[model samples]
Target: MPQKGSRLTPEQVGLIRAWIDQGLQWEEGATFAKAPVLNLSPRRPELPGDEGGHSVDRILASYFARYGVKTSRVGFWIDFLLDACISTRLACCRQ
Candidate 1:
């Protein structure tokens, strides 16, 4: 059975339905079918940078470059950490 939260294309759904209709009998040693790979690459957004650009851009670019969806608060936390580190370096340079 496909795990929850897994995305299935129409074709995949049809195949599963057909399998079930065919009695869904196990061949005794049948292995679980591998799921079709989904290309969830992030799509580029219309705008390069917006209010969520800094945070989102990094996330989408990191994992799925084709889809330009931004990351959650965790991404923002990482950004904050980086920014603080850089600022600390600059402060030390000035002293």
Candidate 2:
């Protein structure tokens, strides 16, 4: 589908004109499907009863531990990380 603020393609314009030429079929309750829902908030799974740590810390620790990832929290990634944090209200880089 064409994006908002974007001009309709020639094909789309033609289709609309054709529909108008056809007297515009009327169908009650005929509508496009609703857009998918978005959850802007962060979601942290409920930890086990014995787990001890903030959800953010736990998530990062688990990721690094499982994947054996290595890297200082410094460099270009940190810049992108900060931007994501700001945009997501600290959800992405909370830990």
Candidate 3:
């Protein structure tokens, strides 16, 4: 049968053909049927908040402490505001 857009290599195709030629033997008690379906419903996961701060900050606390990187909400807001102002000034200048 023609398999359009197949990604199998020549060696892999050869192996498959050999297997088919050899009567397609299977291990005892093994079947190729699909396994039972799992419950895939969406659910909110409990975010880790060990330090009583923002979930993200608490999660990254270990990383920050390990790398000696200090973090503060005030510093974050200041950097964000500065970046916004710079972007606005550049856009206005380009107009």
Candidate 4:
């Protein structure tokens, strides 16, 4: 028993129908239950270098080592950075 005024709009119905029409391929165990918690309180960390840091890599290395993050992610991170830069360039070109 659907109510006349309380029913979904045609656009909303269409979106839902389209989603159902496509195979609902949701990732398995993709819950954000235990995502890494970052502490961004802005404090100088004890880095392995001359008193003050030189480049961002030095700072990032300390954080990565502290968090047990591996250097393998560098390739993925570089690719992601390149993709974002390309997207930004394309957007600027469109404007």
Off by over 4 Å in 3: 1-18, 26-31, 39-50, 74-95
Positional deviation of residue 52's Cα in model 4 after best superposition, in angstroms? 14
Could you tell me which 10 consecutive residues in candidate 1 have the lowest summed lDDT? 47-56
* Steric clash pairs (candidate 1): 41-67, 42-64, 42-66, 42-67, 43-66, 43-67, 56-70
- Could you say which candidate leads in lDDT? 3
Tell me the TM-score of model 1.
0.26
> How many steric overlaps are in each model, in order?
7, 0, 0, 0
Model 1, 22-61: lDDT tens digits are: 9997778688889779999999756443455465554456
- Clashing residue pairs, candidate 3? none
Candidate 3 has a TM-score of: 0.40
TM-score, one value per model: 0.26, 0.33, 0.40, 0.28
Question: Against the true structure, whose TM-score is highest?
Answer: 3
How well is each residue in 1-95 modelled by candidate 4, as lDDT tens digits?
A: 46656888899989888888896555897775888879878987666667443445555776888898876444456678889999999999999
Evaluated at residue 83, the lDDT of candidate 1 is: 99
lDDT of 3: 0.79
Model 3 clashing-pair count? 0
Q: Worst 10-residue stretch by lDDT in candidate 4?
A: 50-59
